[model samples]
Target: MSCEKVLALLNDWLDDELDASQRGQVRGHLDNCVSCAQSERSLRNVKLLVQAKADRGEPSDGLRNRVVDRLTHERAQGPTSLRWTRSPWLRAAAVLLVLASGFVIYSVVISGKLPSIAHATVAEESLARHIGTGVEGPVEPRWPFETIEDAQRVLERELGTATKLPIRSEQLKFKGASPTTYGSARGVRLFCEYKGRPFSIFALESIPDEVRQRSQCCFCRRKDDRYLVACWAARDLYFSMVGTDLTEGEFMAQLMAR
Candidate 1:
């Protein structure tokens, strides 16, 4: 197929709206045509972040408070002075966590393992990247850019494809973007603000199937009331977010809620 034909069908291709033959042709073209592939990936990324809806659901009555009481605290802050020092997820390493519509489940190693980037869960690594900024705290311009479009162009060059990650996903304001490594996968880490609160998002070409599958089933650090680690798979991209102080509902709304 010509680049023009492939471009016209890009959205349909992403939606899986094309028939078998058409899909194959588009896929084949994208596989061989660097320019077309970049357009496809960049458009897909745009839709994933901009058009996506949130599903954070509310926690049961008294659940939030009870969990908070059990969890201990530490002194720390984000690059923006957001107070997330509470080490709720940090307290216990192995815990059963859940979230979303009916029931969302989290896999193992929920504690402070800080596993190597190659093996760490998106949540774990996100947390480390978050707090790991060391004494200086979270700094600005980790990957400097003025607009989301600028970041997109840079990501295109870095990943060998075009990308336009949103400057704002819903209420989250784009803060910064940095190259990141998670499980042999390379992606960008975005610093953002939700209603003035700080958080980090890991947007990668792809994540491990196990991680994505587990996220579909659900994942969370239930006891750590002060902080939230969540992941979701959307189209060709995977996102892992590390934030603090949002209610169970807020967290769920970000991912698996119905």
Candidate 2:
């Protein structure tokens, strides 16, 4: 895909509306293009800021009180000081700063980074690993592993619970499994092939509750049209599934259906 096409699809990509194949094209393009990469970074930063602002939900009483108190104090100051601080332009600037500070605090407290970026970072990593593996190679899982059972044992040793493999259908073929690290957390990834398409499922213990709570069912994002990321929290584990052929809703239904 050209830079223009990638740029045009960025917003849909961020919102998880794009299909998996398109996502892969964007990811592939961004890999070798420095200019597009920079544009992507800038666009992502703006998205993170916007998501942080919305995730804040509502103003906190303490933050509101502080802003109000500052305004009231400035109002009560003598005329000389008022002349310095009471200009309309200065008040607008002050309000903007306060709001900006509130978002900064929200980012720090909620996820220690912008929640969207942090989650997207992990998703991007998953997509990279999956894409790099390609579609037709012999499934070789790392860490001396061969089976999902082995992966479960290793994951249990690290995370204290066996991975809950979500596929129940007889047609889903297990390809391989491996352990992985996302941010500061350790987890396991299971690879499978269904209907000739390969995908990966990841389980991590590091996602913040704030980030997990953003979606009740699944939080999906697109790295490229062919790459889809679907994430959710369960018990003490945060789970993500990345696939080139899967839709967020389909992945969720497969994993979550009883």
Candidate 3:
């Protein structure tokens, strides 16, 4: 398929709304066309960005309060007295102010100021830390437990819930666990290594519906061909694993077995 045709079908292809033959054709094109492949990756990233924004829900309380205060002041002054209502430049400035507020909230989310499973920020932070590309900050690595029971003790202490670790081959060595908080919910992130490649497993008490609806049991996707993120919902908790060695299908099988 030509690049133009591929562009036309990109949305459906990503949404899995295409028929089998159409999907095959698009896949075939993506495999052979470097430009189209890059376009698809860009589109995928856009989708993830939008999902992150939606999963973040609303703006911060401080932002909302500022907006509310502005509105209240405007109400007291009345619309006729409000400069923004009469001056185009002032109206434009008001719009810019709102945009600036949104940018500030986004900056906080990306900076790891808010750690929550409902938002993508925490996941990105965890993955970055695992890969050693995390921003300069205090290292909170906790692990090398002598027994699974020991890890469970820490998990319970941090998350207020006890979760069983999935059985895995000895080739994968357990490193440690880290306490993670997302809003009012709490969870634990477990780190491991497979042949020197780092991997992470985390369990969150509340899973966003957008994530849960995407997969009945488990879902997996690759990020820039560098790593894999596999997630599943089990026993009132949401579980996710990140690494490159394990495929989504393989991860799902193990999760199902558990």
Candidate 4:
């Protein structure tokens, strides 16, 4: 199978969802193709990491109990009988319950006002976008050091110590590409390799009001490549990064460290 086909099937293959014949074919191709071999290895590592995390534990029992109780209450109050639904009190109670459920979902999913599984999922997705889209294209050598301490020293010299944000490389697992410009208005954008992966980082003094209003950004990649991007505002600085050649989880881990 072609590389593209293999890539599309990669997630399923990793999950062991592929049929026996397909799995054998993919394994055979991987044995002969260096690029496919590397991709498979990376995906396997990511699966292992995710499985390890899941094995640690689920959400607290208290949270699970609350969710179960709410569902049970909803079922009990649900249309008891055809005539019961016509009663005004029952109708009002049903409306109130719907509103309450909506509020709970919004709090957990949208506003992130609650500590729940949904909140954690959203945060992880945000981090993945930030780290994955920040960098694109060929991997670049890290600022010339094997250790975080050395990276910190180099970053201090280049960016200075005026900001509170700490610069540490212990978390940087990959680096990619020499810095490049995204567009004139956005200024110089460079692709950095961290934790053995690529991310795009931008140094913008001030984000345009229009960009902030829309909360939308654009990213480009080679025709067949996939990328994830995330952006944030830090004081007067605005930064966005894209990830390529890395799993979403791996990219998020690197970004959260920042």
Candidate 5:
């Protein structure tokens, strides 16, 4: 089996979803491929760690009583009314533990301390290159769209207003369309500055298909730093911008406003 096919099947194999023959093929490939074996081991370890942490605490008496009471109430109504009772506290705790574990794993992976599995190595290299030169060098040239008419004209010439919403310059301080890079890929982006701060928006034409699939729509801040980035998609367009000046909430507000 090919590496990609094996990698895809590994999850199903771990879940015991495969029949004997398919499982044998996967096992054979894994036995010969050190890289795939390491990946499988790492994934299994991470899952086990997260599960162990999530299962650390038992539900309290109060929670147990609530569950029993809810179940009893349902039973009194009819067997057809029966449903599983959920513990909100347990759910919240599980979510917190998973996030914490994921953060630790991400930190380890980003710091280049992880094992040299092929996929992990490629991810590390890609992140490094993106951080090193993605947003560095010359700043994108700002188009002079000072007046309302000028803004409309620039948008018309460069992007054309057909795709963009009408200008709301009255609500902003510095309003114009500018080009910037999104993530690690080279692309043209749009910007609309609010007050003295800038909120960048990306044109749909510029972003690559791969990046849009992986990242979330909300803003992300670099660890131990003030840099904030907000990303969103509108119709065919995708946008992400970074600035250290605004809080995450403020950045998200600006993005929603646009």
Candidate 6:
């Protein structure tokens, strides 16, 4: 496919809305074409950014009160007294201000809701996320699956491309996997149970800088209560291994060897 065709198909291509043949053509073009590949990555990042914005939490009490106060003041002034409404520039600026306020409110709420993630500590976030995520009902989201291979195929469509999965091995005994986010990039989260203990592996696009060992091959561990979160970076991906009842460095030792 030519650059123009690939660029036109980029949205559907990243959204995985294209058919098999079209997807192959786009993928092939991206592999050989540097500009197109960068464009594809940029589009993917933009999608993730939009998804992050869409998942914003509700407005906080203080921000909500302030917004209400502003609206009340404007209402008390009446339309005729609000002279800014007469100028297009001022009207646009007013709209932008309200939108900016909404953005701040959403940011505050999300940070309050997921404090660990807001802090961006890989091990800490891993521990928090491990405690939070798992299958909730008889049937889970994205159609659910029992293996990473099945999950990879399913999530490739969700993420809109061919992809690879993390933390795959016979020893882990995959129980389930789902689509997740790693900062501003796409991620995959998988669950496993071995020897009757629960574990979670979060696969990320890049290794976050918060890890203490991030300076050297990017590996670190955080132990909280019964959970042990070991984060590391390897070729083309980053992973966080969260499990319970493991020693301080047990998971790290094993993961480092691999």
| Candidate 6: 10-residue stretch with minimal lDDT | 158-167
Clashes of each: 7, 15, 2, 30, 1, 0
lDDT of 3: 0.50
How many backbone collisions does model 6 have? 0
Could you give candidate 6's per-residue lDDT for residues 40-123 as a string of tens digits? 899999999898887777777699778875565444334633433332222322332333334345655876632122213344
Model 6 scores what on Cα lDDT?
0.51
lDDT (Cα, tens digit) per residue for candidate 5, span 21-133: 99999999999999999988988887787877876777776997788755654443233212101221112222322333344356567876542211111122332234224
Residue-level lDDT tens digits of model 4 in 37-57: 899999999989888776776
lDDT tens string, model 3, 1-258? 788999899999999999999999999999999999999999999998898777666677699878875565444334432422332212222332233334435656777564232322224434334333312223243322334455444433332212222332444566766655434334555676644657665554445443433332322244544555544442234455566565533433333333
TM-score (C-alpha) between model 5 and the true structure: 0.31
How far off is model 5, as Cα RMSD?
A: 25.9
lDDT of each: 0.48, 0.51, 0.50, 0.46, 0.46, 0.51
lDDT of 1 by residue, 1-258 (tens): 999999999999999999999999999999999999999989999878766765557689999866754342211222212222222221111111111100111111344332222222334544334333422223232222334456544433422322222222344456666666555444556666755767665554445543543332123443545556655443334455566567544543442221
TM of each candidate vs. truth? 0.33, 0.33, 0.31, 0.28, 0.31, 0.31
How much RMSD separates candidate 3 from the native structure? 28.3
Q: Which portions of model 5 miss their true places by more than 4 Å?
A: 1-168, 175-178, 183-186, 204-206, 209-212, 233-236, 249-258
Better of 1 and 3 by TM-score: 1
Per-residue error (Å), model 3, residue 72: 64
Could you tell me the C-alpha RMSD of candidate 2 in Å?
Answer: 31.3
Which stretches in model 4 have alpha-carbon errors above 4 Å?
A: 1-186, 214-225, 234-236, 250-258
User: Per-residue lDDT for 171 in model 4?
Assistant: 35
